[model samples]
Target: MQGDVFQADEHGPAEQPGERLLLDLDGFEGPLDVLLALAREQKVDLAKLSILKLADQYLEFVARVRQHHLDLAAEYLVMAAWLAYLKSRLLLPEPEPEPGEQPTAAEMAEILAFRLRRLEAMQSAGTALMVRPQLGRHFFARGEPEGIVVVTRSLYDVQLFDLLKAYADHVVRTSVRTLHIEAPDLYSVEDALRRLERMLGRMPDWSVLSSYLPAILGDPLKMKSAIASTFIAALELAKQGRVQLRQDGGPYSPIYIKAGGVAA
Candidate 1:
């Protein structure tokens, strides 16, 4: 009875098995699934393909299937009912909406379309998962087989006296003998003073302290100790007024020395 109200076109081409089910109109010939997808994606003009016409075609399809004595699926009937309800809602005049009120007919249609698209996406994902290679069936994990391991440990039994004896022997073998040899004092302050006095007696004019050093000491190894002792001796002689010390340039310049009023 519902099919009679929304019947298919008698002049349309005959349906064939294993062929895509399409809604054949005067200017449009496409599957309803494709139309819904285009609508959801906003790729096609909804004004060109009317919703009322789509619902009519779907009902007509149901009618055609019934004519062939084929049992209709529950989902087909559900979709037909939904299409009819959507059509009625779209056709009727909408009332003014209040604040925080229910959605309008157009909004409800958009929500339904969104839900259908989500369902389609879930189905596509499920199909992809089903076709993917499963573990153990397609391929097995590669790994080396487990094996038993054997470990050998060595133990030594000894007495306290033997342990002490071994420790004493190790210490005796590794112990180092440190010899401290005392180096004799090769040069002294008194010797440096005696030498400087003898040199000053011969040279009456001012001369650099370095000139006096070569006459007093010669060994390179004793140079550091000799220089230190000579400087100390010079200071003592200066304090005693035996020699005069002066630097013409700056603090870092060579020390100029001459015999003072007191002869050393």
Candidate 2:
């Protein structure tokens, strides 16, 4: 029913054997499609199709195509080779397994059947989806104007710069002065030494160095000058035995200048 009678092989007709009728397959997508068509015509289940017979049919079909000198796709030839390999592997005797070991699961017929079943499942799914309702086909969406919210402005409203200037004025008025205002740097080391001597002469003999520093150094600038001058004066006084400077803690600790034999 599928193809005209050309010749007969050992099997009565192309449809009688494990193979299918010799139909023109130039329009078929691939070998699988041809196989599926044959299975459908013969009312055979793809999962239960005979692997050896199927391979034989495919090779026979290829030979017929070659005989007719029809232009063949490389994929068809490749499928022919694969079927030949499957036929050989299926016909071969199973190898004996070692003791306590199972045989390999790489059987050719099982793999081909599994793949064919999967293809059939996919084809059925595609057919079902083709009849289902799709978007932009069965129904159309309503169209409406996109609404945009806009705000109205008044002529009396203040601008961005006005708000910024108000904030700046508030900051300047409420800010506390952290800067230390000090006297000029007119006094030299000698001037500082003289000022320290006057303060020391009036204080006790063992007065703390830090106690007299505040009185001798009037401001931050004077304090800077007095520190350098006082260090030199203390060194000189200690060298001359007029005063002794001793620390209360470790390095960089508080120092106390005590009067020695000398008066001031």
Candidate 3:
């Protein structure tokens, strides 16, 4: 059933797009919700609307809902009772006031009107937000870059930690035990190079660099001389196409020396 007061103007032949023949109270959240909707539709100021006759309209709407056997909530009934009380209070004449006494009827009406205004404002904001374009709905984020593939390290790459560990091991292995003698002994890179050549002749085709630097495990002076000679010898061999040096896996991996042509 339709409400008489809630019905749109029918004086004009054509009705507006949002104009409805009946008030759909079911669309509202509560009694205040219905009042807010009605006030917004009519563009009525909440504070001024209390002075005008709106209590009867509100009560009639609630009564109609109850008459239709529609399940009305307790809030709706409570609001109806409050509206009846407000109406009665408005009708009665004002009593003689004591000093600084409360203005019950006007204050009550103002408070109710203020609350209704706030509710109406929030409803308007919510409705506006519902219509706005959202992040995922209106526009989507761009997919991550698929073209570029980053490689952190390549095969046989020597990381810093591995290099440091290998150096530390080399230091420990090259440390010499002290031996006292009357005469001081001297070592040379040439002596180390000749020794390395003889060792390589007896060794396999491909051997680790340590195999040619056995002096590192003995005297510290010999170890330094052998290291210098080994570097020069390797360079000379590579130039003459006599030896090839390689390091496989990480930095901790042995430096393998192979006969480029034939070992010197």
Candidate 4:
């Protein structure tokens, strides 16, 4: 039954010398064009034509074309194998479909039809493109010749050392600097200790350490240094058991000092 289906029709219409069909099977253009022509003869739409039904006719056409042009049968054979595979897929029973399965015969046929339609559209577009005028060969731009204009200018090739020297000179000219001389601190810790002793002898009772600071120091900056020196001297006298230091309130409270180590 399969052999009968694939067998060529011996009684089909014969071709005359003047009416021979022009086919370029070597170029592989004949297969698709022949199939389209056959579909048109059956009054069937190219997209809806059953690949299974046309399979036999297409194979027969390829076999006959092969007999006339042996050298050109390679592409035709490949196309035949593809159609034969499609035919077998349609005839054979398919397994139960799982997720992410291959496309069915109907889907494959639709895809083939879409591809054929796209191929036809691309071929038409290609033909239209070939027919249009080409640049530099057919069409040309119209413009006047703007002759070359050359204007020479001078250029200096200065060295990196020269650039550095210029930068240093510019910086020296633009920069402003003032000379500062800081005098040495003449007040000593011994001086601070003696001053504290004299102040305590005058008071001789519990007094805030801030009260020991002079009523008039020379300047605010000098007074800051003097206060620091006095505080250091008080710490030394406390260490020596010569003075008693106490804070009646919290840590941040004023420190009270007296002449003797024994608290009153």
- TM-score per prediction, in order, is 0.33, 0.39, 0.43, 0.38
What is the lDDT for 249 in model 3?
72
lDDT of 3 by residue, 1-264 (tens): 332323222232323245334443556666788777666655666767753366777887777666643445566678889888888888997787789987688778888788888997887899999999888999877787568788797577789999999999999888866887775354565766676567655657678876776544657776776676776777666677767777777977877787656543
**What do the candidate models score in CA lDDT, each in turn?**
0.67, 0.67, 0.68, 0.70
Best by lDDT: 4
Per-candidate RMSD vs. true structure? 22.4, 16.5, 22.3, 17.8
lDDT of 1 by residue, 151-242 (tens): 98989799999999999999998896888899965568888899888876776588888777744345655776677788888999899998
Better of 1 and 4 by lDDT: 4
Over 4 Å off in model 1, which ranges?
A: 1-54, 70-75, 98-102, 143-264
Model 4: how far residue 211 lies from native, Å: 59
The digit string of per-residue lDDT tens for model 2 on 1-264 reads 243323333333333343433443555656787666555655677766776777777888888776644435556778899888777766776677678764333465677677778888998999999989877999766688678899898786799999999999999988967888876664465765665667655656576666654454347767776676777777676778767787767997777787666533
lDDT of 4 at 171: 97
**For residues 124-213, what per-residue lDDT tens digits would candidate 4 score against the true structure?**
899999999988889976678777899999997999999999999999988868868889655567878889877666766788887787
Query: Which is superior by TM-score, 2 or 4?
Result: 2
After TM-score superposition, the amount by which residue 219's alpha carbon in candidate 2 deviates from its true location, in angstroms, is: 42
